[model samples]
Target: MESGQGLGELIPPLADSDYYLDHYDDLSCIITQGLSGKIIVNGQPYEEEMLALNNISLAELSNLINYMNSQWYPDKIEVNLNTIKAQLANCAD
Candidate 1:
């Protein structure tokens, strides 16, 4: 099922802001026990999206937080948006 119209057709690219580094640094410092993070999507604060992402069993949520924490890298300016899929793999089965 690899009918490639190119990946841009499936997922539009997001814009990058010059000030994004501040937020990226902020995210790396968040407390995993009760993460209170928000990411903007299409120019709006996306708490709903964040909530949906963490919607899972408690163990999985903890594991997901751990996975995210482990993945913080200052050198990687481009977010692997698909990395969420990789992090989910670390969640409790």
Candidate 2:
């Protein structure tokens, strides 16, 4: 996958059982996928903490990418950061 691709585009699809089998040991993946409604592992329902963690991960990833791009390509990075900040603010409400 390209570095510019979004998380949604980068994530691969997998069956619920298969996802559990592959990622049960990886708490980050399990929480992320579960919060995104992509997979249900071990019959466990998605919880607030999982969703929050997913959101934090996404936010951090976005910020990191934006920062990197900002150092290399200022204009595009500012635009992307503004857009992401707006989206995050909206999500807060």
Candidate 3:
């Protein structure tokens, strides 16, 4: 997906990563919780403090929740699930 790159080109490079190859939960964390905060995302900066990770979009949130439910991480799951769930639940149906 890189500039001027084909799908095959991308796969070969990423094939070396253990994080990419296994530990699929790591991606879930990155997608759900994101890599950083300070940047406003999903109305999070105004809503509340998110420690380091400040935002994830609603679609991303949905993916994350589903991912969490699918994979079992025991004690390491959900660093910010409560806040996200609270915000989402308050949304109009």
Candidate 4:
């Protein structure tokens, strides 16, 4: 539930105000395909390549998403299996 702890200030924090507000929709892609280069989180820049987490099952991912949303965001966003599958299908390499 705690955010703002990256890899020695290299990688961006997974949860942040600007990130959850702006790139919330990209969560599926980021989880499936990983993210590289720089991204702005809470007005600060972070540069690193987060490894893909595609090995986990859809159920696990859905549960993780739900937990994260409940902990970080104001509104609850329940992620279903179908939604996760659909979003993952559209992920870019």
lDDT winner: 4
Better of 2 and 4 by lDDT: 4
The alpha-carbon lDDT assigned to residue 44 of candidate 2 equals 41
Worst 10 residues of 2 by lDDT: 4-13
lDDT tens readout by residue for model 3, 15-71:
223333353434434444434324322222322322323366656665554554444
Per-residue lDDT tens digits of candidate 1, residues 36-63?
A: 3554433444332222333355455445
TM-score for each prediction? Answer: 0.26, 0.25, 0.26, 0.80
Question: What pairs collide in candidate 1?
Answer: none
Q: Candidate 4: misplaced stretches above 4 Å?
A: 1-8
Q: Tell me each candidate's RMSD, in Å, in order.
A: 11.0, 12.0, 12.8, 2.2
lDDT tens readout by residue for model 2, 1-93: 244322342343232234434532342333333444444334443323234345555556466545544543454424344555444454422
* Residues forming the 10-long window of minimal summed lDDT in candidate 4: 1-10
What TM value does model 2 have? 0.25
lDDT of 2 at 61: 48
Model 2 Cα RMSD, 1 decimal: 12.0
lDDT of each: 0.36, 0.41, 0.41, 0.73
Ranking by TM-score: 4, 1, 3, 2
